[model samples]
Structures are given as structure tokens and as C-alpha cells.
Target: MNYTAEAPAVWDPEAFTDAEDCLLCADQCVVRAQHYFVKGMIEIPVIGGDETFSWGVWVSISRDSFSRAADLWDTPGRESEKPSFGWLTTDLPVYPATTLNLKTYVHTRPVGERPFVELEPTDHPLAVEQRTGISLDRVREIAAAVLHAGEDAQR
Candidate 1:
């Protein structure tokens, strides 16, 4: 299912204990107080086949992680890059019970405006399950609960 943020919310960094873990990390990570637009899961069907798989989706505006990635993307003689948005998705499991399967990508504009470019493949799953035909409201509920759970864990 497709998602679009009507009124995005900022996730306070202080709400999470591991907010600093993203810093200097090799993978693209989301920071606190960043505007998260969409968060949900989708089931991907194999083309021309009956096989199907699930993936969790997270989309947000660029923050510290994006800046770090852009800085790293710059070379001695190459043009500087500025990413404005980020998209992260869980990978299809090789097995149904695989863990820590996710990937990240970025773009110069909101995902609603332009496509995102792959920054790097990641393996940090949010422990969310993929469900088909879920409503946007339900997705938001799940996202909120996940964030709240993180905050509670930090406290």
C-alpha cells in the first residue's frame, strides 16, 4: 500500500536512549526530532509467480544522518550532495523468521515529490510485521505505538 503524510510529526530525540547510536555509524540511521512522514509495512509479490514476501517501510525528512551521508558521499573533486529525504524498508526474508532485515535510501526532495536513491543496504529491523490491505490510520497507530514503546524502554 502507498502512504503520504498529511501532517507529519517530529520525533523528539530525548524520547529515545539510543538516539546517539546513529552518530558515526556506518549505516543510515534516523535521529530524534526528525519529521517522520510515513511508516508501515507492505507485502511484495514476486513477479510472474505466486510467491510473496513482506517488508516494513519508513519515510522521513533528512536529518543528521542524511547530512553525514552526504558529507561522506562528497569526494575531493566531486560535487557536494544534499539529501532532503530518506526512505528505509525491511528486506524480504530468506526465511519467514529472519531478523534484523532492513535497508535505507535517500533523495534530494520529499519522497512524494521525487524518487529516493539508495544510500546503503541495512539490517536493522524495527521488529514490525508486514500486513496486507492495512489502512493508513492503522499504520499510524502501529507507528505511534512503536515509537512510544521505544520511548518507554529508554525511560
Candidate 2:
């Protein structure tokens, strides 16, 4: 039998930091897409009436994890809590499906000569319901925390 070695995956510098961050953690954990499994759901604040939304979470494997996804998912444990990768979003301040369309694959590079792969709103309802503006700020906060943690670890 013949086998081929896989190339190591490099994390996206835009989405991740040299230090620890949410994107970095997510990348290390192997989250490829922010999948919305459920529809029209929201998360509530501890004190405020403000609600958070969730479609669901999508976890994708890297070439590194391709052989391990089955083993990991099959084993006892929920994927979200121990997700391949994920991000939680709020229901309020939601971006209209029309407003937030993915023009190209922001997270991944093409395997061949393809310039870009665009995803439309109809392609998947949750695919276009991206969190932006303030929501993105929140995401950045989480990433900052992760980055801070990583820096602390180095010291």
C-alpha cells in the first residue's frame, strides 16, 4: 500500500493573531465555517433584555484532522462544547441576509487556479447571516482574550 504525507496548514493572519485569539483557537481547534444549525434562535444576556442569535455552529476538519473527525465525532462528547470549531452570535442586531454576502472564500484559499468561490444568500440562509459591526467587535474581544492567554503562557 502507498501513502502520501499531508502538508501542514497555515492559519490565516487576518483572522488570527501571532498570540492566542478566538480565531487562532478556532483555527487550532479546526473550525472551518460558522455553521448555523438551528434557525432564528437568539441568546439572551444575563441582565439585559438584549438577545443573541444562533443558527448553529459548523465545524470543519483540516487536512490534519481529516482522518480524525470520524474518531472525534464518534467518540463520547458533544462537538460544540468540544467543537472542531465554532462561534456564537446574537439574534439582535442581525445583519440582513442581503447585507452580508460572502463575495469570496474569506477563510480559505483555492486548491487550484480558481480565483474565488462566492456564496449567495440562497446558497444557505445561515451562510449569509454573518455578524458585523458591533458583533464583530465582540468576536474581536473573545479573540483578544485568547491572545492574552497565549501571551501569558509564554511568560
Q: Which is the leading candidate under lDDT?
A: 1
Candidate 1 per-residue lDDT, tens place, 1-155, comes to 33322221333344543665322122233444453333433343334345533333444534665454445443443223444344443322322443322333443332223334333423323223331233455445645655675688699
Model 2 agreement with the true structure over 7-116: per-residue lDDT tens digits: 11333455544434323332223223432211111121212224343222222234433334433433443232222222222221133343222232212222211111
Most accurate candidate by TM-score: 1
- Those runs of model 2 whose alpha carbons end farther than 4 Å from true positions after fitting are 1-52, 57-60, 77-155
Off by over 4 Å in 1: 1-56, 59-62, 65-101, 109-155
TM-score of each: 0.25, 0.22
Q: In candidate 2, how many Å is residue 66 off?
A: 4.0
Q: Which 10-residue window of candidate 2 scores lowest in summed lDDT?
A: 1-10
lDDT of each: 0.38, 0.29
lDDT of 2: 0.29
**RMSD values, in order shown:** 11.2, 17.4
